[model samples]
Target: MDITSLGGERAAPFEPTFASAAESYLKHGGEERYLAPIVAYFGDRPLKTIYPFDIKAMAEALYPSQSNATRNRQAVTPARAVLMHGYDRGWCNFIRVRRFKEEKPKRRKPATAVWLHAFSRQCDKDGLEHLAAIVLFMASTGARISEAIALRWDEVDLTARTALLLKTKTSTNSMRYLTDEVARRLRGLKEGNSSTDRVFRYSNRHSVNERIRAVCDRADIPYKPPHTCGRHTFASTAIELGMDVKTTMIAGDWRSSSVFLETYVTPRGTPGRVVADRMNVHDFGDI
Candidate 1:
């Protein structure tokens, strides 16, 4: 297809391809500047080829070079390194490439635990029980903070002790199995909330975080909310507790295929140590 043969107006309308969308998102500004680059990671190629990370593609765009004799399976070492950095900061998601002809990178990390305990305590102390609903929901349901905030009260089924999850961390809008705590918390919110009517209505991801930070300072906990560390706390704890991977992923909230487990490097709970003088080993272990 020659350029002259085509009815070329100025250029093609910018279809918001993931990459294009990410660029547009960055330009629009706000929370997306942090989010945009992270969203620009996933590419159109087989995911493994894009693995470990797309450092080569990132360093020198994703171009099919006949002259460039590089193995198709080469690992993007630098990009992987960048991904590690991003993961540490809690931006583990696919980042669509904005540059034309370049493949985007994919992110596969989960939140950590140290930050989550801090956030939960912050909620407990701040009188932000409204915010506490969110902290607890994320911790118990393993739902993303976005999903928890966007949740409609009616979506919660107290009788069933499950909250309906949609349009969340995985970007999939499907029914997710939220836990019993989600129900209890929602009920508490319903009893007292009288504002715009969305549970945690004043919440956006950033504001909730900023508020959490303030709460942390007051509580004497170092205030650092790493992107989705709360969610990481939930999933990692779920995994350690022997929760079935499928059941744990009730809402696709946590991608079953991600390296999230590796990054979930937190002890879920205290291991029991038996004292022979006080108790039998059978008490510590299921006899």
Candidate 2:
């Protein structure tokens, strides 16, 4: 007992539950969709008692056949976030939960300029000028579908050839310059619309995708979703056309170079030919 007093007053019991930590996390504005399943599985369990194996078991139980990426996103991420919250408060010791192994991601094929031209013509033919403008804006500026949907007429400056993105996935405001072609489209779309109105009248991504799918069918072009056709296309096209990585990242508002390179950039056309031509200094008669 005397030794306990000398050992620096015994640490108070760490008894915070996962549920309590989750509640706090949500109160502070953590996304509910990611934390919902996590809270349900680890409800009322003391943070100190939870282990990596328990997290793995929870992921398997919740999403048995789901991919490792899904497991890491839906299970491991939220659980770790909650535990870290608790640890920050000194309610429990930090626990490291290993994420499930993910397979190498496949490179995405972006929509070619030819495909975009075809799609645009079909949209005009189908009386879908608004839809065409939306796609074009995304393809030119690398704006996400959600950002395109939320764009307002006031945010656009046709004379300046710039548009303001008020809310982005990164939770920051960004300013994107409009391409000459995009500015022309916006000018046509703005003629009948009020300054306060949204540039594209669509309310949600689903409706926009549906309209895009129909146009893709009519255009007879391979159907890439809005994301693949728009943001992905912009990054790939910019890089292929000799835009430097840093400049492209700034234009597209990409905060992370790694993410921009890995997720958005994909090889297009015959780069090997360009490389060979550049290295043609060495000549061999016959090998």
After superposition, candidate 1 runs with Cα above 4 Å error: 1-125, 174-182, 192-196, 224-229, 250-252, 265-287
Per-residue lDDT of 1-287 in model 1, one digit per residue for the tens?
A: 76657876456643323343334334544233233233455533322234333544543444355223232222233234344444343445555333223343333244445555565566766568777667766666666677767877666666767666655555666565546655665677787545336666755788888786777677675554534445665766677667776766663355654555454434433445423433663565665
Cα lDDT tens digits, model 2, 1-287, are 76586876676865789999898878887768778877888899988888889989999999999999999999988888888888888888888899999998776589998999999999989899999999999999999999999999999988899999997998899999898888988888898888889999988999999988989898888888899999999999999889999999998999999999999998865879878886787777654
Candidate 2, poorest ten consecutive residues by summed lDDT: 278-287
Q: After superposition, how far is residue 25 of candidate 1 from its true place, in Å?
A: 19
Backbone N/Cα/C clashes per model? 11, 0
